[model samples]
Target: MKEKVLILGGTEFVGKLLVETLISDQSKELYLFNRGKTNPHLFPNINKIIGDRETDDIQKIQAHKWDYIIDFSSYYPASLQRTLDHVNRDLKKYIYISTISVYDFNKYDRASSIKEDFPIVDCSPEEAIDQTMKTYGKKKAACEAVLKESSWLNSVILRPSIIFGIDDPTDRFYYWLRKIKKETKAIVPNDGTDQISLTYANDLVAIILKGISGDIQNGAYNCITHDSISFNELLETIKKSTDSNCEFYHKDNEELRAQEVFLPLNFISNLYYNNDKIKEATNLSFTTYENAITAMVDHFEKEEWKKCMIEIDDEKLIS
Candidate 1:
């Protein structure tokens, strides 16, 4: 029998790519549950259920038994609790796409990169209720808590760093991509020394599939590339990938802050991770920054890159 797979939010970026990935396998039955507001007609042949998770509409999802459940949109703990109340028993495996932001970036000294066991944000029940970007990490931590506390559920929680690729909604990575492709001069921070980790959307999808196949161990894993790169190296890679002749101007963070201009991909402190656990468990190689950026550049070239370009007002910077 073919495996049954259900994705909570399959219309956008990661979820959409995952759906595409699963569709190629003839041995899998796919179902997508979403609000029906985004690209509803993308996958015509697959099962699509329309409902809202925040209201009484979630009942649409309660009627199915899934061999694997990939939740790409669960944010609030209470909301997740509602879904768990309904499908926890029938779900063979739950894969949550969490963020590396769950690590308490401000409290810890991350000179050696963060590990899976590092402390997460401790938010009260009341605080986790809010779903703003400020509380995003705390909220995800709370959701992870719900999965960890569940006695019957076998869950794989993937905490990825910055996830970037085609169809990204946030446009964080897209900012730099467009900047390099458009402008001759780009503003950078701290002479591009601050290091950061990133997970390509396709790599993340592969890991999820591996987890579903029982090739990866259960529990939480820091899902990023095995290595981290500096901002300069990242920009250079982007430049090479896009074949752009943009010259980078390294600016001091304090000066940029004074000018109300924050450079994309510039972190206050390095946010690298120790991803040996994930690599060893999955035994899959990750895409290098050069290759990943090249792929994204190729994607943008095929479409109108300007439509998805992130607006960065160059005038706001201190020239």
Candidate 2:
């Protein structure tokens, strides 16, 4: 019998990629558990368990025994708790896609690169109750904590940095690609020395696949693929990938506010996370910045490199 793999949130970027990759694997049978609202028509032949996590609608989940549960949809501790209550105790592994925001950057010095064992954000029960953007990181931390307390669940928690690729909703990375292709003078932020770590969606999926078979270990792993890189370095990588003739200059915070400009990717000089643990564990090399950005360029090229639904007066900001 094929090993049963159930994925939660299988319609969007990373989840969609996982489903497509797993579909071809002969040793595993794939099933997706979601509300069936997003891209409802996608993967028509794959097994789908339609239900809402908020309402605890997981009867279908209880009916089946899962070999592996890849959870990309559980944003709340309660949602995860509900799923745990329904699923069987026996499983090879459970993989969860979490975020690096779970780490308390303020707790560390600016130069310290975060590690898997770094102190995670401490969340209170009252704070977790608020389901807003402000509580997102804290709530995710709570989710991981909840998983740790689950004595019967064998799990791997993957906390990735900003995930970038095709169908990217935030458009933080895509913005630079479009800016480079459209204009010659790229208005950068304060010398663009801020450090960041990005997880290419494809690379992330690659590690997820490795987790399925390799001598898998269970714990919270920082899933970032690359070392912390400078934002200016990132800008140049995008430029090289697209072969764009772009020049850049920096402007400080006050000037940016004067122009009413809001840039993406949280451009502040800070230490992102370390990826050495994940690399050693998965024995996987990540896609080069150019290759990853090239993928982005190709996907956006079909759309004629259109604005990613975010408006900015380039001329005004550059001036």
* Candidate number of the best lDDT: 1
TM-score per candidate: 0.94, 0.95
Quote model 1's TM-score. Answer: 0.94
True lDDT of residue 293, candidate 1:
89
lDDT of 1 by residue, 1-319 (tens): 9888889999889899989888989888999988999998899999988898887777777788788889998998888888888884866799998988888877677567688998888878777887577888899999999999988898999998888888788888998998899788888786788877788899999999897887876699999864888888889989988889988888888988887776665653476689989998999999888888888888888876865345666634625
Query: Global CA lDDT of candidate 2, please?
Result: 0.83
**Backbone clashes in model 2:** 0
In model 1, state the lDDT of residue 278. 94
| Cα lDDT listed for each candidate | 0.84, 0.83
